[model samples]
Target chain A: MIPNNISKLIDAIINKTEAKKAIWGKTSRNEEFKLFLEKGAVTTDTWVENGIEAIDFAIYNSYGDKIDNFVAYKGDDDFDILSRLHNTAKREFFKVDETIENLFKELNDPKSVGKRQIEDDTPLPF
Target chain B: MKKTISISIIGVVGIILCIYFFEDSDKTLPNYATVIGTICSIVGLSIAYINILALKEESIIISKQIHLTLEKVNQLNSLSEISKAIKVNQEIQEFLRNEKIELARLRTLDLKYMLLHFNNDLLLNELTSDEEYKKLILDFGIDLNSLNETLINSKRKVDFTKVVKNLEELSTYLTKFELKLKSIKI
Candidate 1:
């Protein structure tokens, strides 16, 4: 079973994609944003104080540019990694939602072995 | 049968005793108690009969569910096996297509790694001694380990649907891949 947070993030992405018909439409041509996405996560700092953990993460672009940084008062849960990633993609890419939807569709596709089919298996187009 | 015979004997004896005693004795028979007992017995037997029939129906449904689940498991097993084969095939295809390595060197590296990974000793021995294998290795002039590393590091986007389709097709060919394990047998 997918964790609740991850599932919610996927749902958010799917909703966004369905709202926008195209996957990476022409309007979202932000090169800096694309580079930031490609760079992924850069650095993470974690510490526990008074039985409460605090965490911070710095994100970067491909060209060594700092795109965004986040801090979680609750440590791990604060990261909200998938949601952050989804939001970032929404800001950066035009039709990233659709791409994400398609990716999830394939990942959850019933034809794949050992994968739980979220929906009924439809015959492939071959 | 024994219960029925015993009940019949008791019933006959009871009727004879009732006739012998009640005929000579005063007062009418205790009709109220006997009527109540008969009604209670009838109600109890009806409930038991209904319960038995319900249980039999329930058991049949559970048995059918078990059979369906077993069939699903078998299909999943076949799909799992075919999925593994498809993954290996896709990885190889991707490596060969994307890597800038020489054809002979790449094939040698692929064969070596595949044999090692799968632990196919018989295939390993045959291929290692084969003239083509030796010729390719010698002609390429590349270390096997490094060549394998190059293939491993080469990255490519894999189409998930394509992989699943390939696996489905491979599963369909299980009969041809091994005679003992026919599709129908699965």
Candidate 2:
């Protein structure tokens, strides 16, 4: 589970972004947060299914600005540091699992990961 | 003080009345005793509730201190990392390679310091021994790890040579991020 404080922080950041004129529904930070909110604290979950991909989403999203905004690390040595990061990618993967599981139980109708669907059907035009 | 005294007196008097005069007559004595018992119970519960409220206030104070500590640590680390990353040029990759040993050494020392702080602030605290504390620390470590990787991946995927004909391109954006990280405090 995301620490309530961290969750609040992410919400605050999103709120800060929301006040601005952005074309996105949820800011990148909010999207990263929606990853780890699971039904329970621990157990069989989504991380076990797609570990690397889950963490990659969070990392890339969180670093989107730094990655694109700065080019200092756009080199071989930088790649070395990033490769080291993937080794710990399991954390984000677990977050994804937890988030999906949370939504499942939150709706009070557990379903296979593939069968889960969000209520918002409309896509953002932007 | 008046409430306390009244509750106490009401409680004791009811106890005394119930003891001798009211004991033999269960009907009268028990009735009087119930009134005293209720008053004493209410007063006791009120005092205990007040104590709990005080404790909650104290905990909020402690959590604030911890937050301040975390902010200080993050700020120092963020700006230093920004400075380290920002100052380097197209030749930074090769230059950093030469100083890789020192960089790794610094990282090791920093990790040791972090571990020490975590042990003191988290492991030594009452909650430090708790499972939740352990999980929190572990998750924090994992998050930091992933952050390192994201930085690497983003830089690796991009073609630097295309933009690195001069230092101006890299320096322009690096300074912007440096300002962003150092928005107010250096």
Candidate 3:
């Protein structure tokens, strides 16, 4: 069965992609990547959401595609696939060690991080 | 994985109780008379109140865990986005360099051997040499040094991966936490 969190992740990807036009403005490159990723052999939901094609491809290949991409895009096989996987195992962690360090800077900056206001209906994975 | 499953179980129980309480508020009770009925009523009310309290606690716990997880996921997503943006631009550069290299390789060959070399598949050492073909092979070797750089910066930016791990740790710390978040009773 699809785990609820995983299901929610998948849903969020689709929903976000559907709304990207309003979030990030138009880009021809984004459209090009979108087309390649939509049909590519990989888990493309997130890439489709973020309007980033190569990421979609990388993610697809990383999860386990034959990975017949180019020399350029393939992740550095630092210590073979296992090492890479292990290294990436904690790739998503955000420790936030210095919450106070940059709050003032962020407040002053015009280009603040645009926090994605996740939908109220979207169930979070804990 | 284990922690999440537990929270889900607990959450399901709480939800079921809520639903039942709402739906059967005035349902008929099995007959018991006088003092016995009164005693049972008091006990039952206390039990109900305790259950309500439990449900509320579970709900609060589930909410906190969910928020933590979401925050982490968002952080990781943002870092990945930045990494990807760098990669996309880097790939374009690699594509250009690959084209230059291929052109130089072909240029060095005598015109007489041009078609022959083309047929020999040296230009296509990877694939056929066309504008389209070049685009396909020219990945910008961004993984070499770029990914490390991304990881470092993204770490500073708060990689969501840590949050995912932390959530997994906390949720699994107790069976109750998992049961509640996961909505799985057992």
Candidate 4:
């Protein structure tokens, strides 16, 4: 059976991943978030003796830069760490949405458009 | 049978050495026959001991291989269950796309039940003791729960696009997870 804190950490990681998917539409490039759980020194073949040590959650931007990271050790409170990371993710997502909205607005504004004419010198065979 | 023969050989050699030593107490210097017998007995005991140790080591290696194979089989079993669940999820998505709410709802319920059974099976297996594997199972359950809630909330007016998107995400996640499980070298 999993410990209570470890269970909470697992749930938090799943929740964060789901939220990212909800916002970014399931693409790996868009969902640039990762949660890594540290485990004790144990062979991969022996699952029964594995132990948790820490959990780390990281968020990255489209440019592949790390924007935020949250780490929680074994003794730290899982809920507090997760909530803080969740709020940061929420804020970052809003920022991206706002940027996209502003870009669309700029593209749609008629004042930002400049008309251009193409002059073709080659004669066409009719 | 090999071990038994080795042990019997050692026991007979030990008994012969004991008899040879006890019977030659009267003579100060040992005869060539007794010396030759003792040397042969020593050689036989050494060979038998080495053979026994080699057999023990070979058995240990074979047992470990069997254990690793069993672990891989269990992981593959879980991956197949996930594959089945992915198929059902696709059918649910199709039903939703067609606006067959009743059919989709039934299928959603079916999927929820299927995942419930899968989760229980994972918990029962030793694989759940692994942190990475447990997280994968938990993530899968969370996605299924989200889909179930979305389906249940919107009864008459279903969000076709949203539900389909969720199903697609779930399918993609499951495929990646299946690959991850397959990549695990036991």
Best by TM-score: 4
TM-score of chain B of each: 0.36, 0.41, 0.33, 0.54
Mark the 10 consecutive residues where model 3 chain A has the least summed lDDT: A25-34
The alpha-carbon interface RMSD of model 2 comes to 13.0
lDDT of 3: 0.33
- The lDDT values for all models are 0.42, 0.40, 0.33, 0.53
- The digit string of per-residue lDDT tens for model 3 on A10-52 reads 4454454444321211111211121123222212111121232
**DockQ, candidate no. 1:** 0.01
User: How would the docking of model 3 be graded?
Assistant: incorrect
Model 4 local distance difference test score:
0.53
DockQ of each: 0.01, 0.02, 0.01, 0.03
> Whose TM-score is higher: candidate 3's or candidate 4's?
4
Tens digit of lDDT per residue, candidate 2, span A4-42? 553454344334334442112111121222222211111
- Stretches off by above 4 angstroms in model 2 are A1-126, B1-36, B90-167
Deviation (Å) of B81 in candidate 4: 2.1
Tens-place lDDT digits, model 4, residues A6-55: 45654655465456543312212122222333421100000011253443
B1-186, model 4: which lDDT tens digit per residue? 565566557767765666567655544445545655676677667777777888899999999999888888887787887788799889988887787767776776666565555546642344434454444433333333334434554321324675577567657766765776777777
Q: Ten-residue segment with the worst summed lDDT in candidate 2 chain B?
A: B156-165
Error of 3 at B177 (Å): 33
Backbone steric clashes in candidate 4, count:
0
- What is the Å distance of residue B37 in model 2 from its true position? 3.3
Model 2 DockQ (Cα-based): 0.02
